[model samples]
Target chain A: MRPILLSGHTRALTQVKYSKDGDIIFSVSKDQIICAWYAANGERLGTYHGHQGALWTVDVDPTTTLLASGAADNTIRLWDVKTGKLLKTWDFGTAIKRVEFSPDGTQLLGVTERRQGHLSTIVVYDIVLDVEAEQADEHSLRIVCEDSKATVAGFSYGSKYIISGHEDGSVTQWDAKTGELLDSAQIQEDDMQITDLQWSSDRTYFITASKDKTAKLVAANDLRVLKTYVADTPLNSAAITPVKDYVILGGGQAAMDVTTTSARQGKFEARFYHKIFEEEIGRVRGHFGPLNYVAVDPQGKSYASGGEDGYVRLHHFDRGYFDFLYEVEREAEQANL
Target chain B: MSKVAGRTDWAEEEDEDSLALPPPQITKNKDGTETIVSYRIDENGKKVKTTRRIRKTVMKQVVNPRVAERKHWSKFGEEKGKPVGPQSDTTSIAENIVFRPSSNWKTNQSEEKNPIDKQKATLKDAKIKCRICSGEHWTSKCPFKDTMAPEGENAGAGAGTGAEEESAAPGLGPSNSSYVPPHLRGKSGVTGERMGGGKFGQERDDLATLRVTNVSEFAEEQDLRDMFTRFGHVTRVFLAKDRETGRAKGFAFVSYADRTDAARACEKMDGYGFHHLILRVEFAKKPTT
Candidate 1:
């Protein structure tokens, strides 16, 4: 399969995501710009250019009209996706590490970085869907990360609970409405930090990629680990494909960290692992440097990856991807017939 | 056409609006295809014509209204006022990759590497090839082995380097293979020497060979042999010919079974007129190399 390469970012890419319909792709980089591209081709839709500092995270509301981004400037800005107009900006004490829109378009959650005597916190805001309406200046609820700073946080299905992966290898769940701690579990290694957390299609379970070179599927309600997929290199991001029972993991060592490692050891690839079996099936290799993020299309048509080389590659699945079947799976299909 | 109301630069005065080439022609074919022919002036001031035939098919895909509306939205930010389509500077297509997945994909990858291991899996289906006749049999069992000299010496290789080694005296053919004739097989140094050390051995003595010159270009090896056979039992007759013209090169070698007989023929052949030219005959000297 041929991959369409989008080279709009001037610096390493931090995140790339597909719209709900899988027609648009939004990417944010450390170069302080957010780019939107049409998924059918590599045509660029537009760019949002109001971030003062390097951007770290970006998220789109369910309706795809409102776009939110958090940056190292310690501010989260909202923008109109169609016109790239700046709508609102919320200031914080520290830089926001992660930002995610709740399942419903009414709320937004952000994880603030712990720095300069400011405690890491998870804050939620009531978002107004109308572009002309004024947004609330104050946060509706805030939860202090007392033990470990949360690196990633997302609202559960129906906005019931908020799940956060911490820097200390623990995943904690908090009440979405009351902002109270509920359940916490050490899902990863003792001190290995979790780098990324992503939810399944239904949002009942989520996968967390950690510095321990493994990603775990954890339930959203009780925070119990279900399946663990181990990899050779430290993973930076992980995404579960919707149609196929496969999980794509993106990771590698930064070339500067270990100068003596071989190119293969610095695994610059997106590995596909069978979700239930935890066996690595295949890998797609193209990035010059380590992959920073991987996002699959919600409609199961394609997947896109952002790399430290400052390029986003969109790959559409070939017929072989859908035709592949395990022996046992083939037998079960025949029995059904 | 450009929107330049007036030209400010004198050297570029509205030449871009002028067209010296012919207009493109389009034709509809009976097979539901369109043929388009276009002409242009190339960089070398040469007129070039291009023709293309294409079939058009309509594909319908129903998408959500929100997505349909978003597709027509105007471009903004850095791409403002730009035409619709992928920009060349920011977008490109990468090379194709084969990513077929299988349960035993790991084993499939490692098997392609070490060829010796793959040889075992294919050994039962392997086919035999005869080096001499290229038939399906072993080289030693080929019917053309004795008649063809194993098909290697017939290539006109000039002078083989292995001949300089003289590893086993001189033989009828180059020792490219280790196959010894049925006579020489299982024989040690004593029995081999009695047979004159090689296939040609004592019968191929260089002393009994005579080099004949001033021969006619139309002369054949058999003609030279007939003329010299009256004086001695002719062992072998070799004629040098032109590779391109395939004509005799005015020289031939005639070997006799006995040196005394070769001397008689050399004396008789010298100064003998043939083809209106006098012939010269002398003992053939072995190459020092």
Candidate 2:
């Protein structure tokens, strides 16, 4: 077997995404650098260094020819994926958390947390038209994203909606097209803080991972809780696989400490390695450590994940199981024919 | 020679106001040459037309000596490595598209309505009706130029043109479902090690294991396994298949506890049959990922 070690980024890689064509993998580091590498050979293609702040997230267009990145300095930079040329940068004037390209690639949505006010804003830019219309005074539409007391952690599929989770233990979904409130749910019982939220592929369901040590799947149409799985540990991040099979939750030591104080006191180990969920037929295991970001391949055969450990692992789903605790006894003599 | 039409949702999406429709009927000369004849009809149905005749000529064919040399170089009188003549017989359709047709219609048309005649006929000499709205004014100053032709007129006028529609070709072959050329197909044999299934503890009752004497005997054993595994997923490259159940006979059963192990084994042992026997590989079951 050929083992490839992908170790180049100086610091923790916060985000990594396979190019739309699946030929290359783009990784962003907290070191403020974006690197592209061959997905098969792990050969480094090139590194883009322009962001002044930590590169928090990166996304590529469906054609894999364009790239967008969001930084903690509240700026979103666009780049040509093939040439690594900086096309333009949009400033949000606050700490930007997440940025995403629309499914059609014509629009860019940049979400930022407000430094002064309680509200966050989703800045929408018509990249194709505005880039050519670069004038002294051209006004672009900036919609007020679901304002939360905490950070706005997630956006929805196709760039059609935004779902914001807050420190106040509530989640709000907004209509991305018209900036209207679609639905809101009180995730925590007035005291629980939500950490992250994700939408299922069909856009009909969504799940939230919170400080309450539970991940809950709720109906998007009515905002009703469909089912809940209590990790009984502090959940750092949660992601539902695009195929709608399983919900993966990342548990950390802090979550373990909180769960240990409850009546069912169990020292929750950070289930860092991958695990298969029987309830979700194809629910594959995630990486080891509190996963910072998890993204599945478009083909759904494998997934790339990054964690707090500053490492990324590619998981290939197979039918057989591996017993981590079991050791195989080897008999060496007569079998060597 | 004729304008073809087609209908699709994207075609309808184009701005209709800017597009101009072609004339009803064009003319072809005695020598199989065709020409475009655009006309304007007055309110009384009298027509004033402008025509541009196109010229046609057949290109001469040539015989290529390089292809002939490749075919007959072994012959006694064949000239080897010599350049072929200009009149090479073999030519492809792609070479013909580059030839530009010369414009000689201006001088050849004596009584015919050529470009000069068409240009000379100004707005004052003839009361030309609008081609689209068929009003009293000529098309150059028609106000309805900004609007599409009436829907009923459009639907009825171009029904026959749909089948023969021609587009600027995106080059040869359909964009979808094209097969690779046969010559490019690999002739190389399966290389590397042979894929084998996992090992099972229990041996098969039907398989008869014989002592290997020479390389020829090993090759024959390998052939036997290849023939047997053809029936199902070959689990092991090491084991031969059972002739009766068409299954991996337990004697040669190489068990990969999982599909990943089996796939890895297959990749490693792809070409190498057994050392003496030619080996065939099969998956015990379908792969999971």
DockQ of each: 0.53, 0.00
* Local error of candidate 1 at residue A124 (angstroms): 0.8
DockQ of 1: 0.53
Question: Which lDDT tens digits does candidate 2 get at residues B167-257?
Answer: 2012111321244344432221110001122222111100111111122322333553464344333322233333344444332334332
**Residue-wise C-alpha lDDT for candidate 1, range A1-337, written one tens digit per residue:** 9999999999989999888889999999999999999998889999999998888899999889899999999999999999999999999989998999998889999999999799899999999988888999999999999999999999999999999999999999999999889999999998899999999999999999999999999999999899999988889999999999989999999646645666666888898888888878888989888888999999888999999889999999999988878888899999999
Give the TM-score, chain B only, in order for the candidates: 0.34, 0.16
How do all models score by TM-score? 0.70, 0.44
| Candidate 1 residue-wise lDDT, B141-175, digit = tens | 85445433343332112133222223223442244
**Each model's chain A TM-score:** 0.98, 0.75
Candidate 2 lDDT tens digits, A1-337: 1123355466666777775445567778788878765554454556676899888888876666578899987778887665566777777668666666665666666667766653677666665623334422222445664445545444455666666667677877777677677887887656676766655655566777777877777666566878776664676556555432445566554523443453223322222222222122112232234556555555444455565555555554333321111111113323453
Candidate whose DockQ is highest: 1
Candidate 2 runs further than 4 Å off: A1-5, A20-23, A129-140, A145-147, A153-160, A188-193, A242-244, A254-289, A321-337, B1-289
